[model samples]
Target: MLDLFTIFSKGGIVLWYFQSTSQIFTPSVNALIRSVILQERTGNHSYEHDSLRLQYKLDNEFELIFVVAYQKILQLSYVDKFLNDIHLEFRDRFKNELQSSQWFSDYTFKKSYDNILVAAENWGKAQAKLPKQMRTFDESFKSKKTVASMIERKDDKDNKKQEGKCLFTLVGKKKKGTNGTDDDLISSQEVLQVEAPKPVQNVNGDVFEDPLMMNRIKLAQKFSGQKKKADKQKSPKPEKAGKKPRVWELGGTNKDLATLERTKDKPEDEGDYIGADTTLIGKMKGGIQDLEVESDSVEESDEVEEIVEVNKSPVQKKSGGMLSMFKSLVGNKSLKHEDMLPVLDKLKDHLIAKNVASDIATKLCDSVATKLEGKILGTFESVANTVKATLTEALVQILSPKRRVDILRDAFEAKKHGRPYVMAFCGVNGVGKSTNLAKICFWLIENNFRVLIAACDTFRAGAVEQLRTHMRHLNALHPAEKHDNQTMVQLYEKGYGKDAAGIAMEAIRFAKESRFDIVLVDTAGRMQDNEPLMRALTKLIRVNEPDLVLFVGEALVGNEAVDQLVKFNQALADYSSSNDPHIIDGIVLTKFDTIDDKVGAAISMTYITGQPIVFVGTGQTYTDLKSLNAKAVVHALMK
Candidate 1:
């Protein structure tokens, strides 16, 4: 059953809250829920807390959290359907209010909340009557075993019936074999034994159904018949008693006997043959069978001696002949640009297609071409493969950071020095400066740091209110810790039309006095061509020297973002008198998830400005911000 349903902005701000029962809701409970939602690394939206289960459905701008409480398991499909319906209806009902800040003050919000509560109650009643069989995990597993046993018994019975039919066919065939003559039956058995088992075929020469089973039956019957015949032949027959009793009598002619005796009595020397006569002696020496035995014996003796010699000697090693020769001939040869012109041209096309800026792609290709020239290619490496390897290496080098900034480490260091770690965000208008500032504050809060947001963008009409709204939402998720009666994440806002630089300086002084660990200054969004606005931005940095200045840009802006950063840095150098000129320490890329194929902006920005991209905005939510991964970016670009 659905116990709770709530809607949250992407910044982890709870926009709407509902409870089905009379359960008490507390700030701690809200914090716990937010922690679960924010700390989720995998995209899985479901989490369990005690007997309650929480499932989240994410939209582009909002997240719907459904909480289910039960003693036993209920059908999740029903719960999902209920939540999805509510989400759609809520989106439709408050579409405009959700995007505007007026929803909090609008009187219609109460009526909308009441309507949603009534709908949720009706949905709960409808789901209670659903024909869903809720079961424990153990009970469901036992029922599955019962069904599996029934299936197994049915299969065994069917297999037995099949075996009976095959056996009956074998008996009928055996009767025909018994009626044939013994020699013919033996010859037929031998032929069947020698033949390979083939698939049963129909009259059309196509394979029959159950060909494998039929082939097994045929082979079994042939072997069984052969065994029976062999048994019959092995049974010894009684010998004929009178057949072996006959004996030869010595009745040979006297003259023939006298001649044989004379030849046998002759001297051994007279039997010796010489020269041409030796041919007849050789012919009479042995039969074909005897000669084959003698030749086999001689070969076996030679083989034995060879084996003995091999065992006595040490083993010889084989050298890599062909491989070594090939390596020597071509492995060390340097690559030339002319040799890889075709491959480089194709690579450039691929990069451009993947949304890399045109100039950046050309430069990348040129750099790769320069590195490839006079570089040794491995023995098995092809020109295309070598070029790809070199290009990946160069990209990795550019994307990789020389030194990483540890935000927590820096914040703690600032605390030791009795000052907060101050960071300011500057970028052109509509680049999501205020939203990203809240996101970083949320991150710092999650890391256990007390943070303060300075609303210094007094030039923009509703900027202060926007920052306050963000603070309201974030405070609900991670409430401020009270220090000397001052709340964490408190906003320092001067009304519109005030000096922006003075407001920032006051905010920093307030943070130092309040003992806050970090302060995020939200500066007014301005264009680089606006000279007065650019001067104001520079003055803010000079008056209140922030530890880090981040340039926020949209990845969808492509190569033009580089131009904005360059101009901003130039203005800072001209107006600021500090020995260390104000420069963008890192970059924050917004709408990173929206840029599906074109990822070249990040590379172009970093390569041009020589700054590292620190964080990327994956979605509108505060938790959507993630650390930039160089390898992941390169992989996405290459794809």
Candidate 2:
């Protein structure tokens, strides 16, 4: 066989020559190395004759520049161009690596060959700045006859030759086995290729020089002169030529984060996905096999040379052993700065119970991780404190604790004991009093309550309109409309009543006369301080006092107003005689539609008077109103 250098080098005398020179333009980094840089070092020597010798040294920056120039100069190539060239040049090296590694697990010869071709393409891209002569030599074989032959094939003639200028030019006739060619020379299998690139022009007339892209690759190279950089700074590789395979290098936190909890902008519910590409997994597994093979070879041969070179490759840095990575997390407070899965699990239900969001629950879990080591618990007090602080802040931004509690408590109580047979709703104007009343009517119906609604609110046209809309919701839930009649109400001192006392007398007289099993009185939320109104209400109590009085108040009014209601009604709890009247028996926290808030929710906490919050208004929709449960409120605030 001819020396590899003789085949590669552009210096050879094909005695009795029938020379044929083929020029191929390829985008490959390997093809980039085959570029003929004919510099005019001599000024007009015998009509400007400059010998085309080779420059041996190049930096990564130069390689990147060459890569850019190659793309611009080379025509689009596939098939027997870049891939075939790499295969012809490298030959059995990559082929052997393919069979040894079993790169394509399906393990067909065609697939393995393609995979090896792809890996070379990727390697070509990585070493894009390598000097042309040094690429093949430094690439795999060092100081071999291939390198020598690559440097000296056939010396170029003077300017008269102008070889490879137009098409596949015939440099000369072939030699016979590194000797003089006989007369009848047949086709030769191996031919030297030096790509004579045409100057390609873009539409803008300016070359697309990717300087940042070039610099990025330069910085990524393993040189002592360079400072270390974050993985995010690495440059993106250029696209491979057609039919050329390229390696997939997953870098950067967003792509190759080791932890399961990745904030990759995918949906929060997508679950843990850590380096889950089958092709990538196979590549990783191949590396492991390589390590195992090396380990076995070392044990058998007692080879110290192989062991010394282990740390030379970037693989040593990247191939973090799974066991070692786990060990690192053991004594650390966090793994990938993430809380344990168990902590998140416990916090999740706790937050849900407290009325917190999934995202906040997750944050709470992270905060807990700050106070712990692997498999160990954070302080019970710290955990509680953190959860409470986070949840309190969250709830204050959303809804009040006391109001939410009362709303939940009452609804739960009602649900537990039995949906209310006789329940009343009370609240101020625009406090969603009537709307909440409609909600209760709907909830009772949804829960299969024999609900009976009385539209005794004979004032506020919007209130009546709002309630009518809510009645539709109630009707849908119950499959039967609540019986409502306005004539049964004795509101506004209208028609025929003697005075306030007489009007109150007839209001109660008429409500019972209706003989309803469930009676929900929609009284006016005019004033808690009004004496005449209170007197009239007292008259109703004397006549046919209702079973429950759910005094409604605006929850967004915050703790101060809630305190007023609780204080006022709770004070009335002591009243027994006709002179001293019971003002408010229980509370229905209202106006939940305008606020899903924190300061607003905390403000309602001032009304923490042990009064069971029977109902809550959540949204403008009657369906939005949810009954507050105390336990649920406590969990929401803490978790």
Candidate 3:
């Protein structure tokens, strides 16, 4: 103890105290240091996190750094002195075991389990510090669909690969009463609380003779047989809806559908590919028209001021909260960025083709159907959805008494005057932020606008290659790193067709040199510790005070996209001095042509974070970039 006191007085508490946690010390004074480090290793994860938080709370209390240090020494190093701390170990183990036993078996049966575990993991130990009523598991799981699933099978052999699944069929049949309480009352063959038949007084004060009780088992069997017989006699689920050969083929009624009726076994309906070749061609053509119309609508309506008319569905909207809403919004939806990007990108290209199709052909329902269907997998349900929506639109237009004229008015009231000239892009890696930046250079050159780029991302091995690749792809990009000194000279040469000091100066140098029309700087991923790197970014901003500074982040990031907005804002904390800080003028959500969980939470987060979404990466092609429109975004995500 005296030695420890000597160590503490020497300011060497941690280095001297080998009795505590095995950690030595961080180079800086940050209580959340290990918390952050451990966080990087786990997402939505819980493992002794609460205990650490509890320790943090205690450390902050009573000005007891050394006392807390000694407590931690006792707690973290308990294993070393196991014999003396057996009770502590036993207590912790028992709690953990109890939590484990009570945890959700699967997401379905896990309603209570997940809430309990999350509540415990995030705040398990906080109970000592926080109120018990506020920490109720029932309260935590009070959100919609928190405890509902028809097919939660608890009988699976326990091999916990995190969770298991069961698809349930809703079986609602009038079951026969068992034990013949009705029959027993009649026959006196079974025991009952009340006599088999007796005069009883009703709540309405009417006296009536009770009906005879029947044997429940026999009645149940009879009812069960009756249901089975009915199932055998009923017709199958529709293979065709009225006159229209249904695109959604009734596959020999699944167990769920079978409850209603056993669909009659008819000749194979090799669906989608219409047997009538003539009708197929007509539908395909109409599909093509639909695609073109939708694409054109997107491009045209983007400039309109969009009033957010939420889909006031009787069903809940998916944006109630992030974690809960996302799961529901993407029901049976793919999470991988790759799976969806190509599909959307392909749809875009298909639309582009339809847009260019002859005016006469564009109007025909058959042309729209033909082109869109050709792109669809014959086996997919989405194909039917796409084709049907198009046909429906076409029918409405044709059947209208007046030639339908959607006025295509500018929805946006043009921001008072016009718009701020900030530009950004959204798309996947190969979609070309660098190439587009260079193209903007040429566009600026043609319009006599000045522009310079800063290459701040030093992590990706091939990042330099991509920028240099832009040099070849656009013939306007420079092939050198930009640091602190030569940025002004490079911008001068780029703007005035002359060379400046060198290529690698501060980002501010380029902004200062040309500081007017536009100053484009390339950024990177892995934005966690953007501070150490912000000197270069700050130098660019201060020197040139460029009209717009855009943060270039990936589009296909899905849920983690929120992290980019957070980290970047942290890095640029100095700039956000006012109600409207020198925030990111725009966000470029890159990689639009991939299969990402496009929850677009990033866009919504932008609003919360006070940044504007200014551009979208439409495809893999260099020209696929488009201006951001809130309505367009809402439509894509909702559809």
Instruction: Order the candidate numbers by lDDT, best to worst.
Output: 1, 2, 3
* Angstrom error at residue 367, model 2: 26
**Model 2 TM-score?**
0.31
Local distance difference test, each candidate: 0.65, 0.39, 0.35
Predicted structure with the largest TM-score when compared to the true one: 1
Per-candidate TM equals 0.47, 0.31, 0.31
How far residue 220's Cα lies from its native spot in candidate 1, in Å, is 99
**Stretches of model 3 off by over 4 angstroms after superposition:** 1-436, 442-450, 456-465, 475-517, 529-531, 534-544, 574-581, 595-602
> What are the per-residue Cα lDDT tens digits for candidate 1 across 1-639?
456666665556776766677765444345445443332211344555555566656553333443434322555445555556666766665566656754554356556655655676677677778897788877776666765565657778898886555332222233234556443323343334222334568888996446565455556656556442221256687887785755658655777776558342232464321122112212211111110001111111111111123667734333332111111123657777787676677778766765567777777777676445556667766666666667776666676665676677888899999998999999999999999888777777666677889888887789998897777665555533433334557788878988988888888898889788898999889998889998898888888889999999988876577678779889888877886777788888888777765677877777656677887777776666777777667666665
- Residue lDDT tens for model 2, 1-639: 000011121222211101123323122323323221121111111110121211121111111110111222232223223334433433343345544863432234345445644665556665565665635544555555464556633444434356424332334455565555474343444332323334446898965534454454454332223444453476889988688566568534565455645543332354322221122111211001100001111111211111124557422222222111111113322232243444346545644443333443454444334223222323332222333344344433322322222322454455465443345455444555666666555444444334445554555455444444445444433332243522211122232223433443444444445432244556555455665544444444444455566767675553246445644454444333555554555566666444433212422332233344555665554345555544344432441
Residue 300 in model 1: shift from native, Å?
59
Higher-lDDT candidate of 1 and 3: 1
| Residue pairs with backbone overlap in model 1 | 10-621
TM-score winner, 1 or 3: 1
Per-residue lDDT tens digits of candidate 3, residues 414-475? 11223213232222234356655654443333333334445544544665555544433322
